[model samples]
Target: MNTALDPTGATAAYLAKLPKGAVETAAHYTQGSHWVLVIGKLAAVVACLIILRSGILPRIAAMTGSRNRQNFAVFATGFAALLLQALLLMPWTFYADLVRERSYGLSNLTTGAWLTQSFITAVAGALVGGLLFIPLYVIIRRAKQRWWMWSSALLALLIALATVFAPYAAGLFNRYEPLQPGVVHDVVTDLARQASLSGEEIVIYDGSKQTDRYTASVTGVGGTARIALSDTVMRDPVDIPAIRAVVAHEIGHYKHHHLLILAGAVALLSCIGLIMAAFAFPTALRLLGGGGVGGISDASGIPVLLAISAVFTLVTTPVVNTVMRLVERDADAYGLNLAREPDGAARALLATTSYRAPSPSRLEEVIFYDHPSIESRLRVAMEWKAAAQGR
Candidate 1:
């Protein structure tokens, strides 16, 4: 796409329909349907928790014979809740995040394209995370004694698996591309792999699919190297400096080990959840009804797990995002050095992220925004450029 001002006149206007207010407003109340879909997942985390805490089965168990039965009641209830949550949220998340992007000018996908992408994402998440849950549940049941250690160890395995899963799925869906040489290819390569980011094609998607915005990224780790730019980017009259600056910032993510760091954080999180679930979940066997190692006892321990997991989520999300912001700062700084130009980057920042208050409250950025606001990045870019030029 031509981010250069369209000399073709009307081409610029037609492509420039992304309204700042609309985007800003939509950014407010917020949404998504596919739940754990489109890579902006919530299915495994949110919905699973809800179903357990719903108390449907808990009420049933509480009224039954085993008033002290925590294990069976919680386990059964939690498993059912998690499954139900996935069934309900995955479709919604798929629609809201991916579909809406295409629908509201944020995505440039045809209905078929959108469906294909959403379906792929859903299948991948379910196959990797959803399917694993069932066996994980069963395993906890069988190894009730050493649940935490086994669970933690299992968590580590799952985390390792989860990290590799996306890259494989990306290839399965024909999403992988060898990074080709471009103006910034060498720089991206240097950033991704210190000694061997070579032959890696910078896989970028047409991000302009749903909105007239300029955004780019280095997503995934190791072999799953992907870089995406919205269609809004090419059509817009953004100066090259900002484009390069942004690209460089994305490269910074690779260069500064952001992927490795993010992967580590995620691994820790999943490990904790798994280990906790392993120990915490097994305890429920003593709650409702259980057959010990064999038969059916009372089957009502699932809800307890749900309630615990839900409480953990609200606390963990904020922490994860904070870590994300810290890493983003590092990438932004790196981008400044690589781009070697700040003015164009600043201008591009303005045009692309007009919806984002150049200066958001600290809390807003922490809780709501993922990437640093354009102002924040541009600020660092200009500051660095100014110092380099002795201005």
Candidate 2:
């Protein structure tokens, strides 16, 4: 191959603009977060063990003192345990989400902003958790031997609902505005048209309020479908070709319905995890001395259930990440082919190094990453360009 057409050389030249120090800093932050996440999962498991051993949940369940209020007891006990877990994890959350992000020059949020977002997110999560927990225990008690199957189905439904409503849920944290008439906007509209998407589905949002990273996605379904670009992309030093490539990538997601497909995949994974947790629940209860807990249906069993779920989640992280990474890489290929802007795609991927590491070892990427390394994605684009040039 000619030097001008060498994919590896071309990709390197495109990425050469990124300072080595910047890539190193991003890699340090990202890799450090991987360990933080692992440690957090371990800590959560330990907390659950402590809670179960303390018999605090049983004590909470006993507060109602009446079998008629079993539902209420379940809600109260579950909520209290969740609250305790949150309190236990607050310090770690603060460091990983706020302190560390700011240190890396990634977060654009002030302390007050962080606090506000955290409070809103926590409250919303608690409400959703309460709603789900009461019924989950109800399913356990009523369904008995078949609880796992029915409960998993319910969880799948909830996941689908969440996927459909995500666009609205996101509005609670950031303001979304329409893209103005401009080159970027026009390019996005053209790409959407090419991908058979409605122009009304594209919007820009104030994502810079939270992070300095360049981010975009196609969210929601049907009537709520939105191709959202962060205002970070609209700021000065706008790279038009890169924007076009990124938008095309998101358009590819929409065209292929990747979000719904991913939601289904996640729902299936959740079902598998729940089934495994159900099988382990009795054994776990026995190991924990079955203190003050009647069975899996008992409200006091919530801590043990949560612990089992955490363990399963930790074990399954790589599987979930692999599925997500494959979809992302496929979307990149689809976008490059559609947009015919391989250099732009390469540049756009390089821009992700603001927060993500540009490169990682194969094992690290397989185990920890939810997207292809920037290096690999750039190479894909360069290879596509070389093939196109040869043709």
- 167 in model 1: Cα distance from truth in Å? 4.9
Candidate 2 segments exceeding 4 Å error: 1-4, 286-290
Error of 1 at 61 (Å): 19
Cα lDDT of model 1 by residue, 1-391, tens digit: 4233322232223224446675564444232221222233334444544544455655644654574544444444444445465566657655665565555555555667666766665555544443455455555667765555566666676666565444444444334344456544555455456423444456554444444567666655544546554444445353556666677777778666776677688778766875565555545433422323122222444434544465455457767777888898887677666666566566666664433544567776676566676556755665565467554
lDDT of 1 at 319: 70
Clash pairs (backbone) in predicted model 2:
none
lDDT of 2 by residue, 2-91 (tens): 545898988788778899899889889889989888888877877777777888888888887799988888788888777777667777
Each prediction's number of clashing residue pairs:
49, 0
* Residue 200 shift from truth in candidate 1, angstroms: 3.7
Among the numbered candidates, top TM-score falls to: 2
